[model samples]
Target: MDLINGFITIFSSPITMLFIVMGSVLGVVVGAVPGLTASAAIAMLVPITYYIDPLSALAFLYVIGKAGRFGGSISAILFNTPGTTAAAATILDGHPMTQKGQAGKALKTASISSAIGDFTGEILLICGALTIATFTKQLGPPEYFAIYVCAFLIIGSVISSSVLKGIVSTLFGASLAMIGLDPITSEPRFTFGTIELYNGLSLVPLLIGLFVISEVFTQASHDHSKDGRHDTIKAKNPDDDHLSMAEVKRCLPFIGKGSAIGSVVGLLPGVGSAVACFVAYGEGRRKAKNGDKWGTGVIEGIAAPESANNAVSGPSMIPLLALGVPGSTIAAMLLGVFMIHGIQVGPQIFETSGDIVYGLFAAGLIGIVLYFLIGWFGSAFIGRQIDKVPPIMIYPSILAVACVSAYTARSSLFDVGLACLFGVIGYLMRVTNLSTAAAVIAFVLAPGAEQALRQSLLLSDNGFAIFMDRPVALAFFAIPVFAISLRIYSRMRSEKTPAEMLDTA
Candidate 1:
């Protein structure tokens, strides 16, 4: 079978297997460290992909993201601090369980739930991408442009605390995207007579500057002079350290619901694990019989958020693979990897790059097993080790590596300087509540969107009427309208809550 052959192809490469294992371990370590995320790690390492084949490069980053999602729960349960925002909800009940000396039980619940959720989402990705790609292949420039607009509006509306800030960040990225050759006429617009500016900006440096170097700057600003100590509570009884079959049965419903919720969220552009985990936690608590006692060290609380967060790792690739749209920040980084390898994404990828696609799918499957093994068997010890490392030591090394990686992309000192500049901008954005993820996605999507819009206009003398002629384009354009209406209605409901309570009184 083609499926069997595809997996076999991946297995034949020893380098790919080696990187998968290395990535899993590295992801776990990085994710266990507070303030470090899988996105930042991948951003720091994207330049290294230049030395490897596409299959190995893609596999390494893909596994890192998958493993990193599960890794965050370790610290959340042990230290009462979430390494990633996706794990923030886990601390609600996870730390309480640790306080109760049921740390192992809570950890097992998180690990198994995460693995099942991730597997479920990956299955959906494989089936959904191929199916959607079949239809997406038939779409023209008008429909593609409409879809891009819909993505932009919906993503900006949902990702940020303030919709205005999100839209502004997205537009800012689009403006930066205009600094090179014009998409339609090939005229240089903002090159400033510099050869380096001719290509606009390289993605590797931008990613390093924004996600990796910015994080270093943020970390450096924190006080790391105090000695760190481990005060992890240990389980006294065997029952406290192991999850029984009865407990697994109790968690199955929550796991299933959470996985489904995460898969759906992942399919939408700009939605991330942080949102999915919280949503799943809320839904799980509402449906449970023990809902009233939900936050009192309940296993279901840990299961719901952990599962949903990891489930987001897989289906987030659906938009990128099927429509060449990056749905999340990690997916945006992966888009850069795809472009670097000279592989065009979208429906044509299956036909022209089938081997690479199948290899990536195989790697995803293997990574799930590898990370699950690590989480299930080694997470407790890993957490203990992470708590011992001083923040003062870890960040300086990271800063040095980030600078070196930025320069390696083109051997240009200018790129290093540019990365530092963006690092400052990124820190400011973080403090200002602006969505850097929105900016990154917009940067990747804007060029394609502009080209499609221009091509559509050239095809029709009637201007915007071309979108009306295509049913698909019209439907795509309508999505943002519905999204905006729902957002406004939600805000209105929230604003009216106090008045309604006063009236009742």
Candidate 2:
């Protein structure tokens, strides 16, 4: 009944409908452009949400996130360049299909599989988030703190190739998050005597800097002088441009499996679409009968990764809605939006803002249909248009927009400067293989973790031993320890040479 009202609310508002449509179109265009991600687009546009109503803002950004994941496949198939990191796995077979003159078929397969996978994840989100939130609401401060610790460790350990670097990145973000006044004490901590610093760094500027401006800086560093025109491969046969029923039937199993894998991955904080897509692709190949053909223009190959990539969109919101922990970079940005609108997230969200929550869910359903239609009929055209816009032109414009957006957040020049500073830091993190995503997530989660820990301590008569009394807290604490140990064991095993293995035998 709430959901039906949500649909009615959206359908009745022309402005809301217009924003959704615009978001769908813009998300595709941004995602189709190589080096431009949905995260960057969202970060740049987040400041704009300050002027809009909460539902419209949430609906617009939410749809963009959904559409953007699908749009990445456009560049991956047409140009062999992944528009976002999640689309990297798509390139394994997507570009190969284009080279084989089956770009249309691959795009169609990707669109269908992505829609199916995303739909599956959305159903899980609608059903699962509230249920999870119900359970989470029963947890005390000890449990919440432990959960935050688990998130910090798991995100730091898993997001980057090097565990040390990932941990360092997370610590860096936590340190930055500490720069404001102490919340409980109301005492200045790391302000360094600046009035603005007393309130803490603005998230809008920080996000714009890290995701949007950083990408601009990275792209500006690249040489586009030798870049030439990429010709679109025409289908050799008319059938090559069309997907048949048999092909869809054959791809269904892989699509289902990919969606499942993606949903599970999305439940884990900071294990993002990039990981989900690759994992799904690898699993699909392992289970497929003609696995050897995976890399050679197989429509099944396109279906697997594309499904998993987009499927992460919905379930990734579960943590935020349930536990107030963002599971992805996009979710982190949305956290800022929720705060901006004075809507408290977490278990009480459905109780407090049930209409808005249900409305957002309805908007997501509408977005899925809209993006699917656009992807099915116009992905090729979007790809061609994006291809014409050179990196030289795009990055500068993005840089300008990022700067303007940063400034717009607070109408402060200091925020713009802060953004530029973080852009350099973000670029450095990128070049050094550090997880910027981990840093952002940590920045968002750290304050809550600190509060929870402090509150738990205050409640405890036996100091640290209080955690021992709670089985749930203990379980949460044990997770990171177990994960880190397992990671170390795996690394050691992988590092062993053939000679070492033989000697051990």
Question: What TM-score should be assigned to candidate 1?
Answer: 0.96
Pairs that collide, model 2: none
Stretches off by above 4 angstroms in model 1 are 225-227, 495-505
Mind giving the per-residue lDDT tens digits that candidate 2 earns over 1-79? Answer: 8889999999999889989998899888888888988998999999999999999999999999999998999999999
**What's the residue-level lDDT of 420 in candidate 2?**
95
User: In order, what is each prediction's RMSD in angstroms?
Assistant: 2.8, 3.0
Candidate 2 stretches greater than 4 Å from native: 495-505
What is the C-alpha local distance difference test score of candidate 1? 0.88
Q: Report, for every candidate in turn, its global Cα lDDT versus the true structure.
A: 0.88, 0.90
Stretch of 10 with least lDDT, candidate 1: 496-505
